[model samples]
Target: MFKAYFTDGGNPSDLVQLARIAESVGLDRQRAEAILASDEFTREVRQEEQLWLSRGVSSVPTVVFNGQYAVTGGQPVEAFVGAIRQIMSEAKGGTVS
Candidate 1:
């Protein structure tokens, strides 16, 4: 869907384009088209968006670790490594300090 919308300049809301994108991703095109045409996943995606909004997420590529530490936006590799180290330390019963 993202590839279709951003890269291919196709409408993400269009089921045909969505099916094509899904197929490109090695997914079942027919099943993907059916799901896109149906209202089944709409509520799920909306719920996830609402949850992100409630969590103060207003941007894409937000990374949440263990549902505790959240780092939004694209960051330097060092920043990601630091976050991972911190999360790992915490998981090992040690403080990030």
Candidate 2:
């Protein structure tokens, strides 16, 4: 589970454990394990890392509003509500300060 990484302190020890976790979340274990062990997965992971790096996402829990306004890191419920309201307001041709 993602909670294993974020909420708890459980980190994957190896590709096997990673695949196990994926399986636990309903992914095909054998297929996921095979993919994880391949160079394709490594390249895909690296590409995702680079993509996030270019997007100024250096950490987890980053939330974006219409791909324009971003609330990074851990935030409160009110913060999310505020971002959503602002985006909605902008979409309705209303300005948000």
Candidate 3:
């Protein structure tokens, strides 16, 4: 799917191409095609996309930690480490400060 999207410029709306791309990733091509043809994961993906859009997400590579905090764009390694530490600390009832 990533290759199809980035390399081939394939639209996510194209189910056949999506399944073929999934197969290229070593997934079960037949099952993948069926799943894409059906309304199973498609609805879930749309819902998640909508959820992110509602949260003012207007770009790709948006990373949401535990669905509470989010970091958008291609951040540096330190930024990712900081975000992880912050999320882990919050999960353990600690604050970033």
Please list the residue runs of candidate 3 whose C-alpha ends up more than 4 Å from where it truly belongs after superposition. Answer: 7-14, 35-42, 95-97
Between prediction 1 and prediction 3, the one with superior TM-score is 1
Q: Model 2 misses residue 85 by how many Å?
A: 1.2
Q: Considering summed lDDT, which 10 consecutive residues are worst modelled in model 1?
A: 1-10
**Which candidate number would show the highest TM-score if scored against the true structure?**
1
Candidate 1 lDDT over 34-57, as tens digits, reads 887789888899998898789888
lDDT values, one for every candidate: 0.83, 0.80, 0.84
Sliding window of 10 residues with minimal summed lDDT for model 2 = 5-14
TM-score of each: 0.76, 0.74, 0.64
Question: Cα deviation of 20 in candidate 3 (Å)?
Answer: 1.6
Q: Which one wins on lDDT? A: 3
Lowest summed lDDT window (length 10), candidate 3: 1-10
> Could you tell me how far off, in angstroms, the CA of residue 87 lies in candidate 3 after the best superposition?
1.7
Model 2: pairs clashing at backbone N, Cα or C within 3 Å: none
Colliding pairs, model 3: none
lDDT of 2 at 60: 74
The residue ranges of model 2 lying beyond 4 angstroms of the native Cα positions read 6-9, 95-97
| lDDT, residue 23, candidate 2 | 91
Candidate 2 lDDT by residue in tens digits, 15-71: 777887889889999998888777767777888788778889877779867655788
